[model samples]
Target: MSPRRDDVIVIGAGLSGLMAARELEAAGRSVRVLEARDRVGGRTWTRSLRGHPIDLGGQWVGPTQDRVLALARELGIETYEQFDRGRKVMELGGQRSTYRGLLPWVGLGGLAELGLRVGQLELMARRIPLRAPAERADASALDGQTVRAWLDRRVRNPKARAVLRIATEMVFAGEPEDLSLLFFLFYMHSGGGFVRLTSIRGGAQAQRLKGGAQGLSRRMAEALATPVEHGQAVHAVLQEPEGVVVHAGNRSLRARHAIVAVPPALAAEIDLGPARSERRRRAEQGMPMGSVVKCIVVYPRPFWREAGLSGESISDGEPIRATFDGCSPDLSFCALVAFVIGGSAGGFGARPSEERRALVVEHLVRLFGAEAAEPVAYEDQDWSQEAWSRGCYVGLMRPGVLAEVGNVLREPAGRVRFAGTETAARWCGYFDGALRAGERAAQEVLEAMRAEVPGDV
Candidate 1:
């Protein structure tokens, strides 16, 4: 039989690919979505834990992320504020403290230093262009230095440095030594600012969808004319002057254009024909996903709330680095969501599941008391173990890589285009970024189609 044909073939049924398909369909184009995994939502996944819904992947939607928020509203998905009602915990250098407001119990001097550093980052980030950071005059200087080196020069207090390190892990899921200063600045600029990227009250993690983060993608998939085809891992993409053919196992799909919406590293694995640019290949090879293990522990009730604690914490010691309250609306069940990130995640994720759970419980016991020792259920998603995902959160850029090949991030190779959170200019590495990138890719294909077929527009 001849290959199935469509106006466009979207490889990967994640948020980015689904958004692209949605846009193409709205523009009177036929679309086919192929996904490697047996599910949708990409990095955003929602799973049940002890009869309670828990987001095992990307879950938070901030206030400044208007695109995703608008999409959620359009899909009739309701969102609720993240639980931040009581005091937050801070554990640094083997000492734990509780504070009612945003700033933790860092010393007055440390707070002042942190404020100064943030101000500097905000000012510098604003000056750097989000789309083309390599073109900036100071790009070479900034890109040459890692975030760790930059922090060393600016921050003198140990507590302040630790806080920034934890912030870097939480945001990028990578160590400061592994990230470029220019890339970090560009990321902050893309997401609005440092404050917006890290805040919960009115920031990037301000609200979460009622059902889960995956609801947005699921709803989008439901509205599409073509249902998503899962378990079809694409192996190669062949683009010619007339059309493109995507090969998955024994099956093949032909289309006028194609969108490769998987992570950059995963995209590199696909066998795109000879038209693929060396720059694009090198860029993808250099961009690797950050490591993280998302852990959700469910309890019968919100035990910490009775102690006047918010369940939000930043810790320097243990298998987990951060914690937040993930209780469902109406207080049906209480869950504590924690992140094991960076090198710690690598070590912890390697151990037996029971051992990892014990460590998490032990750590929580220290923070929230003996009540935290027992839970109804314990679950975690080790992104590194996922065959399709390899890693979580988003991809990261090392020193000098962004400056050398960042310009080719969104450029199309022959008839094959790219779309993912990594390709977005605004809100890069977030749900909003994924949607924006997908829409942009769809627009590119639509414009090309119009040009190819006069009067189509």
Candidate 2:
């Protein structure tokens, strides 16, 4: 039988791929979307816990992430602020403390240290060109250094260092030692700097979808004229002089253009042949997904609130390093969402499931008191273990790689264009970034089609 044909073929049904497909549809072009997983939404997932909806994956939306917020509104999805009404708990270096407002402020000394270093990061972020960061004059120097090495050289306060370490992991889901300083700066700047990325009231964790973040993609999928093709993971994308041929499972489809919207590593896995661009191959090898385990513990009530606690905890403790209140906007159910991230996520996730739960309970007990002992239920999503997604949140660029080849993943190779959160210059690791990337890739394809066939766009 002849292969199916479409104007454009979108690989991966994540936010980026969906967005790309949606744009192509808006432009009156035929589009076929293929997804490996049976479901859509990619990294953002929301499941039920004891009859209450709980986000198992990426969930938060914040200030300056206007694109996603607008999308939610357009899709008729309401959003609410993340519960941050009381004291935040901190367990650092075996010491436990509670404080109100944004940070747990390491100490007056640590405060000064954090302030100066964050200022430096923000300043350095402005220096690197957003489009082709490798072209920056100081790119070589900044990209060559790991975030860990840079911190070790200047940050003197141990507590402040620990806080920054946790913050970096929470943001990038990669250990500081594994991240490039230049890449870190770019991520921070793209998301509106250090404070906005970390804080609650005006930060990245500020707001969440009333239903769930995944609803954004689900709604888009429903609206698209053509249904998303799940369980058809593209194994190869062969660009041809006429168009493109995509092979997935036993099926082959031809299209005028193709958009590859999965993570850097996964996109690299698709057999693009020896003719594939060297820079894309390098990017695929250089970028690895960040490790994380998002655990949501359902409780009978918001117990920590009774103790004048906000349920926000940051610790140097094991098994669980950070937690936040995971209550619904209407306060229908109470839950505590915790995270095991970065370098420690692997070891902690390696233990038996029950053991992981016990450790999380124990850590929460230490910060929020005995009330945290008993929870109605416990659920965790180990992102690294997921076959479709080797990791979560975003992909990390190895040291010196970003400088050598700047944003190569975004470049279109023949009839193929790429779109993922990593390729977005704005809000690079967030859903907003993914949306922006999808829109940009779709526009690129649209322009190319118009250039080739004139007025078809």
What is the C-alpha local distance difference test score of candidate 2?
0.88
- Write down the worst ten-residue block by lDDT for model 2: 1-10
Clashing pairs in 2: none
Give the alpha carbon lDDT tens digit for every residue of 411-430 in model 1: 99888999999999999999
Q: After superposition, how far is residue 149 of candidate 1 from its true place, in Å?
A: 0.9
Query: Tens digits of per-residue lDDT for model 2 on 170-200?
Result: 8888899999998898888888888889888
TM-score of each: 0.98, 0.98
TM-score of decoy 1: 0.98
lDDT of 2 at 302: 91
lDDT of each: 0.90, 0.88
